[model samples]
Target chain A: MISEDYDRIDATLRSTLRDVLGLSETRAAALDADTPLFGAMPELDSMAVAGLLTEIEERLGILIEDDEIDGEMLESYGALVRFVATKTRR
Target chain B: MLRFGPDQGPLVAVALPLFEDANRVRGFAVAICRALAARGVATVLPDLPGQGESLVPLENCGILDIADGFDCATKEAWNANRRLYGVALRSGALLDKLALLDGRWHFAPQDGPSVLRDLKRIKQASQPHIRLSDADWYFDLQAPADHPDPPVEIAGNLISTALLTDLSVYAPWTPADGGPVRIVRLDSDPAPADRHVPGTALWRRAEPGNDVTLARLLADDIADWIATCER
Candidate 1:
């Protein structure tokens, strides 16, 4: 994706995480490329993952297959954004 | 039923989203009702069968039963000589089809298959080792042939297999289906809607939450839409 599109996806991912997890604005804004998610974030338990992925798909206008989800894609903030960016590009 | 605003005017009955989303958005729905009351639009948030304060068990209730409960709520208002309008959030859209209302307003309405998909995902998330097929996820492969199919538990809700089957095909009422319908969606969603508003998806929150600003905005929208319908 282009730089502008990438930035938009990154912002969307941040907001999606905040909304789905009910995080504060400051916490959401603090997320960055290196910020670990999934197991690292206390709010992102297994059940929360389901809502998070569905919300991401709805907001990004993309479909996320069950198998496409794995620890690697959600390992960090940047990884999730890149995964979504790839899906949008497709 | 939780009643708000005036008692003798047109009534706007509200339906919370089904299942877990209903819990997540209950506070938000109440916020909207209170905001609508401030706008002088009466609203009622009812406990549908097998949901909220209702005594009925969810495992024993089907889509039609819940829909009938909603219909009954509107019928009570109709009997009292008041005009009725429906305001539903998320999967709540699927429950208002049988209600007699002058107009229907839906916020981020979810279709049946999509609701089922979310439930399935939640169920799968709770049990990573079990591969749940779409055909018979609630059934046990090793159980006796004559054994009764048991209810499946998803994220703490004990839901019946029959209800899941009904949700596979149930859909919200639309303008094309013979009614005045207004659909409002969050700006992030790309789905077709009569209007798009700036807001996060409150129902997506893992815990129950409220968005007072979005509630006020939607209340204003619903009030304005109801006025136009009355005209």
Candidate 2:
């Protein structure tokens, strides 16, 4: 049940990434679970990252701290999905 | 007595932002207040003590002291039809701690100084300056014969380390309400000029040009906040 819930959340996240970051379908799909978002996309600089985090929090009802984020955590879409799941659990 | 229309304007209180600079609302504060006012609520946008046209010098005030002054201002103005919703743009979000001042809120954190710096870094990798017109001046990385990679940097003791610290502490995603505070966040990517605050009925507007469009958008947002808070 939880995995199914995770999948739903994951799909929403992908859509959000596309909508908020203005990513094309192909570009967004090219992302895997552990891809590095910060350096990978020039658009994902600090401001975008901050905006992304805000979008995620509003969508998933999670709170994130600047210190809580790191390269590995935001590496990919799958990674972000897992991160959201973890945060939601808490 | 006069009857107002369904699209009647909101009740708004306007004042200068909290900063050493005399003009400009903080950032996200503009959005929050505008959203509220758009809903026919009542809101007030006050300038911090020692800033704006208030006659006090920026050097004479500290963060906490500024917060205190704002609090006092809100309380003195509170009335039956008025709800003090403090709006803080960018680093101004820290002033929400002074919400106890008005006990009413509609906070938003727009692309503040650090975020602006980060954008400039990504844009031209250079610092920014205030032009004679108070417009944020930037170096054109594309001007050629310049350094590698586009970079725009904004420098000055005006944006103090203390100000940076205050801004960094705010997490726009989570309102002190433990939910998404009514907000509209602007993204630098693809440069969408407008945004919508999710979960809440509020709107988030984004636009390029730190001059007219930015200021106008903020003013619209503040107007909305005042409209909503009035209820």
Candidate 2 regions exceeding 4 Å error are A24-36, A54-68, B1-11, B14-61, B68-103, B107-231
User: What is candidate 2's lDDT per residue for B15-60, written digit by digit as tens?
Assistant: 3334322233333334444455444554555656556455655444
Model 2 per-residue lDDT tens digits across residues A1-90: 287887767766776677657678987777776666767777776545655666676556566654466667778777778778888888
| lDDT (tens digit, per residue) of candidate 1 on B45-146 | 999998999988998888999999999888778889888999999999999988888999999999987888788889898988877775677766777779
> How would the docking of model 2 be graded?
incorrect
- In terms of TM-score, the best-performing candidate is 1
Best by DockQ: 1
Interface RMSD of each: 1.2, 9.5
| Model 2 lDDT at residue B146 | 57
**Candidate 2 chain B minimal-lDDT segment of 10 residues:** B200-209
User: On a 0 to 100 scale, what is the lDDT of residue A84 in model 2?
Assistant: 81
The CAPRI category of model 1 is medium
DockQ of each model vs. true complex: 0.74, 0.05
